[model samples]
Target: MMDALERVTGPANATPGAASSAIAPVLAGPPQPVRVLAAFPAAVYLEHATGLLAVVAADGVQHPNAVVLSVGVAARPLAGLHVGQEGTVGDGAIGVGQLQVTVARWFDPSPHLRATSPPLIAGKIADARAHLMARTGSDSHDLAVPADAVAEALRSGDMDGVLTAVRDLVGAGPGLTPAGDDVLAGLFAAVVTLSPAVAPEATTTLTRTLALTGGAVVDRARHVTTAVSAELLHHAVRGEVADLAAAVLHAFTGRRPLTPALDALLAVGATSGRDLAHGLITGAALVLATAEAGDPDRPATTVGAR
Candidate 1:
């Protein structure tokens, strides 16, 4: 090896005793895709006989086990290694080793995954509904309405019933202000779009559920918000809605009301929501904007229609 000065110094400035020495490492082949586990702290090797080692080596989450092959980790991906191939994902590995044990670490589930515990008052969905209901008592008969009635209103197309029942539950006391703006934001979750004519019913179910579940409402809301937001960012702006966004919209709006949002959606010039479901989210946003624009009594779909 060259001396310290010879290595650090430029080739031209090499000392008389030391020969000019400057070497750089060469890059290997093209980048290869490596499988990574996101759930746990460490990665479980994709043992062939053993199957997908735990995606996450360690985690509170109950780990899903993989199937084992006869020989061992397949020489290459052999014997249909798709069974236990799910979990969080991260970067690829550097070099290759026998398909014995792969390594992995926990992929941070931040903005992607909603926080489960200590729900965000506004940021989380389920919690917002509860908060909103708590502030606004049920509007049904003074007698506590049966859960069946609540479920029925939601399950059947009883928008008016749901609104009236929930109104009774909330009672004449004070209004149930959602804990924060998060409540509205969280509405993105557990929401399905309906035909424009049926939007009132969808919102009715939505408001009722929020008041009832208390805790679950916020959690679900977070999930909805995240799912919908992601879809919008990727697909809607481009054009069509992504799978998740489409699903959420369908679920939240129901059949009757989403028609206008759908019409609005088809009208815009954009690509598909493959990257993100931006279009569907746009439809949802328009719903809110329309609601805010006027007629607290009027449904969001009516504005889109106009």
Candidate 2:
């Protein structure tokens, strides 16, 4: 993406140069010429899946919603675009108001998945869980009961019970998005990966649940976020917990961590990280149990000190 941006800006013009003589400045004080390098018609959606304001073109190309032109906090150039405005973004003299895309300020959802000491990750998860339990009105128990039920249902290959358990848990917690939705996201991600037979009904139920609680705004956001999470969770279950760590991170921090994903999750809200961590752990455990129960001949994969 940087390479594409550089090609448009050119190497010599990467940094801000003097105002061009050809064009006059839009502002009164400084006569600066800002040239539009690249522009596209994009449907700006706050992807609740990863918490990014995805700017995808009609043809299905994703553009970087935020771009930094120079160094320091004052050099933010793309901060002035609006959701429904046809504006120019380019290399040249820019004013703060004209360039400010207030919505872009929220598009930092990427997961930081790095190789780390498994013990460190485990410890962080434990701390997150404890913190969540102590919070006022925390719904960990409310969420956990259905999770356990789902796991037990998966163990017995009881598809009916599994669907029922999942339905009971959907829209189960507080908040606009709800902790239950996050758990369902994690649980469904794992189930679809390990137990394909149950994926169809499980996904349908989850979609209905999201629609019921999310309303128009959240329902629209889920279109992107839920899909991205599912793919990441698939990658996670196939390998180590590290693979899905980004999925857990995206549930809270919005942006993926550049360091360890666990560190990102543990550093977030009063109980947001804790709740996501709980869902992730539960999803992973349920996947393992389902795999073991479904195929007794296949050796079970062990994770961490357990």
Per-candidate RMSD, Å: 20.5, 12.7
> How well does candidate 1 score on lDDT at residue 54?
30
Task: Indicate the worst ten consecutive residues by lDDT in candidate 1.
Answer: 18-27
Output the TM-score of candidate 2: 0.41
Question: What digit string (tens of lDDT, one per residue) describes model 1 on residues 214-245?
Answer: 33333333343332222222211122222233
Candidate 1 residue spans exceeding 4 A from truth: 1-81, 84-279, 293-306
Ten-residue region with minimum lDDT total, candidate 2: 19-28
Per-residue C-alpha lDDT of model 2 across residues 1-306, encoded as one tens digit per residue: 333222332124233322211111121122222333223333233322222222232222112222222233334333444434443323322322244221111112222334332233334445444454554345255677777776566545565566566666555556433566556555544443323322233234333332233233233334433433332232222321222344553332223432255445545445445555566656545444433434456554332112
Error of 1 at 76 (Å): 13
Estimate TM-scores for all models: 0.20, 0.41
